[model samples]
Target: MRTMMTRRQLLQSIGSGFGMMSFAGLEAASDPLAARQPHFPARAKHVIYLFLNGGPSQVDTFDPKPALTRFHGTSAPSGNLKTERKTGALLKSPFAFRRHGQSGLEFSEIFPKLGACADDLCVIRSMYTERPNHEPSLFMFNCGHVLPGHPSMGSWLTYGLGTFNRNLPGYVVLCPGVPVIGPQLWTSAYLPAIHQGTYLPNNESEPEKLIQHLRNRNLSAEEQRRQLDLLASLNRLHLEREGGDAQLEGRIQSMEVAYRMQSEAMDALDVSREPAAVRARYGDGDFARGCLIARRLVERGVRMVQVYYGNGQPWDNHDDIQIHRRLAATSDAPMAALLQDLKASGLLKETIVLIGGEFGRTPSVEVSGLVRVQNGRDHNNHGFSILMAGGGVKGGLAYGSTDEFGFKAVEKRTHPHDVHATILHLMGMDHTKLTYRHAGRDFRLTDVAGTVVRDIIA
Candidate 1:
């Protein structure tokens, strides 16, 4: 019979060889949020994803399909695309489109503010996903899989690049209220909990309310530091007695970070300190305030910051597609302000900005059995549109295209995995090389499939 060697016993046998070196490596790995080097020189040091929670109608937004008007209320072709609900005849966009910027990128009337800044935007009109439903598509966008229990793109970035600022979380998610799938969308499944996005409800602009329990009312800064040091020492002693545990080490590191955050987080999250003109530029509202804070966070060295549009699929206009104009109104000013501010601050050169949702709405009008919807569209995973700017992406260029009817991606089609790969590439990470071994297989953000869309790179 062969006897199995315990980890301690194996370490004892290898003590004279590489035991000390191995222990040193383990200690270094303890601080999961500690900054690490990228695979190569990175074009984007930070990322800010403006996630429009519900699928936005591409035909009504970035992609202008005049063909819809030509075929409006007419049914001739029997091969129309199927959707989540039974759709009526083609619906023409109520809003008008006008060319903007030197690129001649067309923008709908609703996004006049964003349209003015069109030169900096790279609109991809041929984007598609695997699912049409919110839950699966949301998971697909954030975690790279239709199913849950996978690390999100933010988590992967933090895991790969670690954190630039220890005082604040490397990955931050700002939403006024929970989206449909909730925290699972930002979860760091299979990755260290520390890499999970730090969710902040922007409903209240108060810094204290945004970051609950940020300060200890009873303990002064010095006293809190002393307490943290003692607690860390005790934890270290316990770790030495019980071999190394990743979870325990993570908890210890989190405690240390929490202690440090008490001093800096308050100042970082407080947007009221901004100049009056700057505050006025971003406007007043949870989404707008979240955008301002996102800029502030990226400026302070946070790796990835996601500002969701609003709570619970706010853009899912089932009854009236005209509601899109209202939603766009709320977003245009803040988004434009963010881009302009980043450029003025010179942060735009090093930060990547992504805007879009999980999927897009169908071009044809949708009619549900449960209710009557006159102007709204159904979910369309066949095609969608998203915009990217800054980083290393070419500005003022629209890549790929959808068909004339705007029902599907017909030319130079791109998938979410491809986008993920492109994003990691911009961040100087080879999606294939950046992998975590689990379940006896190497898992990655791109999964088994992903091809970097290199043409968009500046």
Candidate 2:
């Protein structure tokens, strides 16, 4: 009979994979959230951003305007300051709008699944941005400025709250091809290089390629562990000899996380491990998988997960509105499933979910209306719609609205800064207080403007 190996001897000879399954081992398993402590106890420990990429038309999805149906194919009621395009008569949504849940919130048929979760959602109908174009507006929405060079919200979260998961990055971004502005939306900017989001490609669900730079073939698990253990010891010895060096210390910690992540991160993003019914619910598509992965990462203590819906202007339907119908279908169910799954798993109470784009489309048709069938609208920056749920928001509520014809935001308007402020509030960080001294002045996610919308808070 073979003699039983001691714990240390086993670790030296075998791998940590088998050991990571045990609770005691997991407890001893390097705490992933070592750096992710919030400034205070937070209402939301995690965030999932359902970015719609190019913009979705409000009239066709969340906000319905019967008034527009009354005047379809004619110039709208609102005068001047209109979209800078060929104006057409008001066009009603092609799909029907029905009141859902006890909230009686009206959602167009385009997103049947998301509408079901209406009671848990706080839809902001009067969201407005400063840019009508895709790139600048996208940047502004994620980084707080139309130009890049600014830390993204995720970066800010990591900087302020640290991270719950040391093995994985504090923030993760899932995109297939590219967002309108690409990496700028998740860049670290003035923050430390480590605060930048870890980008996971859309098709990375494959076991072999799920995580880049994590698959190492030259060494066995025991060999790698030995190397990291030796390196960590050397780092500690050097730190003690040098007295104290923060930069060197941070590097030491980063190296340890990178070493341990080979096992932890791989398991975190493996969507294949999900049961068939579970995968089917999210839909067997890139966006769907992205949503599923978002849940897994956040559950594993990742702070923020941004799931971009499609590649290169999927929602930028300028010439054909019907084409948008397809894009809408692609995102609808997976987004809804993410919410439902989170709720059932009891994660929704502490996880904030957001859905919107850079801006919305014009109420009036611009291109696809041969003189009528698909009346595609131009990009509209003056007004749009955004949805929020969980993370300390009161559900079954609509914070603001546009005009009767859905031309512009008329009341209770919420700006991008307000959204930024609210998110920080949920994370227990006062947007005003979470500042970093850089470029000769203190910088923050809200820049110089931001007021947490008190009305939306429960």
Candidate 3:
């Protein structure tokens, strides 16, 4: 039988050639999720973002203002700062604060379990954002831009470093239901769509229900493989005709990932396989389940896992600030368990765990017509707090602070850009150098502003 030359082979034999150049990079382009080397010596290999959606009150959690407590029900000195709604006298945190562990890091009464892990947490009390509203701030926190059409930090990481396991997605998002901004929060935007986060609505306990259509009931693995091969050939031919299409290539890559996932994805997502004792430690609730799943994903070589606390900004406690205590109760145990579990498994040193919300709440009572209760706090974009643990960060350190009333970042003031830059730096990428050409210019997670806050790094 005579050997038939395919279009790829025909071009390869013609001079130094188009096929040689294009197909040489073909394998690399086809496997976009293949693991790659970091820009330098990376301190961390994985990141787990514990997104506490909406604004959690800093004064009620990590940042305690003695002045606010002292002058409770009195006008704040910094009350002149503009807020989204009208506010009244200073609302002192109802929850008391106390020092924990050798770090002496203070925590609110609601977070006893998390406070136990204080020695491992690096609290940033001076975190600020560009907006007081949820939508823009969420965009800023996740995508580095105050707009929706930008790749999230997780998307950027997966795009930059890829993943170790080709059987699973490089980036994963866990939420019981739709988050505030929905899928846009994790979109790849100008980046290849394959780099976008694989979202899992983790409402079900069973792995099959957790990830719908995870297994095909109609076809065997071998049969499915043959079908995919044929489909791939057709896609490649179409791709050649179109010259090149990033979106089309992305879909091809994503199809391969979905196929490979049939082998390992279910096992990775099933929390029931974990020991009964382990389940007890993580506790019961959507947030708890998400924390456990985050650990599992990172353990299995996923580049990044973003676990949102709940759906529709559950932490947006505009009516009653006491709701924070209830929310913290549900999240505290799981947060601590994740830290302890990572440390026990020796993954803590190479995995970064970031915990915080979009912004923080005002120290004064929210007395606006929009608010239902008289005791709630307004949104405060000027100041907030976030916690970082493991991944070569200096634990037990509070790097910055808000003023006496906890209204604004006063010292060592840090922005969302700074946090993004610092996270990239820890993962061995220079913030300024991590760029992707989109439209007519280059875009990055930190945009034009961001300095690696190296002091927090070990």
Q: Which of candidates 1 and 3 reaches a greater lDDT?
A: 3
Clashes of 2: 10
Q: Give all candidates' CA lDDT scores.
A: 0.86, 0.80, 0.88
TM-score of each: 0.92, 0.86, 0.94
Q: Ten-residue segment with the worst summed lDDT in candidate 2? A: 1-10
Candidate 3 Cα RMSD (Å): 4.8
Q: Evaluated with lDDT, which candidate comes out highest?
A: 3
Model 1 weakest 10-residue run by lDDT: 1-10
TM-score of the candidate numbered 3?
A: 0.94
RMSD of 2: 8.6
**Compared with the true structure, what per-residue lDDT tens digits does model 1 show for residues 79-138?**
468778878788899999999999999999999989988999999999988877999999
Candidate ordering by lDDT (highest first): 3, 1, 2
lDDT of 2 by residue, 35-104 (tens): 5455577788788999998898988888888987787777765552455456565666777899999999
Residue 311 in model 1: lDDT? 92
**Per-prediction tally of clashes:** 0, 10, 0
What is the lDDT, from 0 to 100, of the residue 39 in candidate 2?
A: 57
